[model samples]
Target: MSWQAIAKKDLQDSIRSRTLWATIGIFLALILLLSWLFTDGSGEGTFIAAAGFTFLIGVLFFIPMAGLLLSVKSIVRERNTGTINLLLSLPHTRGEMIVGKFVGRSVVMVVTVLAGFLPALLYIFVQVDEAGFTQLLTFLFALSVFGVMWVGIGIGLSALVNSETQATITGVVMFAVLILWPLIFEQAGIELPSFAQRFWLFVIFADLFFLPGRIADGDFTFPSVVEFDEVLLEELNDVAISVGPHLQMWFVVVLVAFWIILPIGIGYYRFSTTDL
Candidate 1:
């Protein structure tokens, strides 16, 4: 109940913040602009083109940025300004405070994601066939989860650090590690050890941006982005086979769960043990 109260307050604060509206405005503008560019005089392939474009630009970049922007400061700001002490002075425990902040900020991030993708969803429903509509829904669901994943990471970092600058820098570095490092390694033909390769595979699988292509290709293979050498592909396949049981849909869910929960759990521990 205390967490609920805290969550309500965070949601209200987000609603009042200009940053929220500004993000929504910019997201909508991007979605609309992409939709316009993808649309022809006739509506052929409009939805597909727009949706793919959105997933590439919107999901890959904008959603992560927004989630981090809204949440990376959630706990540290309160602590730095001595407001966390004020909050704890109420009926709230540290656990409730963290849960409430996560829930509230997660809601803001999810809502922003929906607002960003709604135009594409509408375009798909209006101009595309039923199959495309189904794909659009699936894409939206994946994007929403991806957005929440970043929010959890941001909240965790917020709670983990002592200051906004620390949180911001850590958030950026973490993002780059999870996103950029894998990309650079793959592009440069650099080979990681088996375990590291699997971790990167897990990251790409969790992002699920390739879901549409997977569906279209009718190839349900994990890490479907690989177009590398046959030997490397065979090696990766061997690794996947070694971890076969863990590569199931359930394992994917578990991986995602860890991404969202592990950081928050660690952050809560740190927050609880550290003095305000």
Candidate 2:
């Protein structure tokens, strides 16, 4: 009830700060720059999937960073400046305020991503007509869901941290680890003996953060690498990790659902009970 009022006010503050416009500008520039590279008709043979996938990759990198930037200092700034007390003196309770901040910030992030993504979508429709409507829509949906998840994470981190610097450092480090962990894990046991290398293969299958990137690109099958002997033209069959129906797109939906709920849920619990 009172949450709606707080949420509206939050939206207004973000709008007045022009953060929304700045986010849109970042997306627009990314779309244009990547689109040019993707559609340049170079001899490298860039197809519809390639262009769209590349664009999705950009969305994966930029939108989450934007969400983190928007939210890392959200609550702490208010608290530090004594404005949070003023907000509390209004009609809303702590729970309402927590819910309002999350919802309002999430909406802003979603709208900002959509606005920036549309031009790229339109360009893809024109430059890569073969990409098709359904696939594009699917990619868009995945990107939107991914962005919302990060926004929720940022909001929760904002509520949980004591200072903007801590939230920002944590967010940046987490993002870096999430993006680079697979690369690190890949090289981890390379120098080990075959026995240890075989075990490391199992560790590679535990990649959770990279799955959303697969969803965004519409490539859902689990990664399986096969080594071949070029001179002999022979294939060596190795052990394959067995994955069930649990690895489907619905699995990604579940992951996104957990991300969206868990952070805000914990933040709400803490903020609701913490002294104002």
lDDT of 1 by residue, 140-183 (tens): 77777778888888989999999899998998988777777767
Report the number of the highest-TM-score candidate.
1
Clashing residue pairs in candidate 2 are: none
* Candidate models: Cα lDDT each: 0.74, 0.65
Instruction: Provide the global lDDT of candidate 2 against the true structure.
Output: 0.65
Question: How would you encode candidate 2's per-residue C-alpha lDDT over 129-237 as one tens digit per residue?
Answer: 3555655565566566666777888878778777778887988986776556556766785443322222221122222334545666786655422211221232234
What lDDT would candidate 1 get against the real structure?
0.74
Candidate 1: Cα lDDT at 118: 85
Candidates in order, TM-scores: namely 0.80, 0.74
The regions of model 1 sitting more than 4 angstroms off are: 46-49, 129-131, 192-243
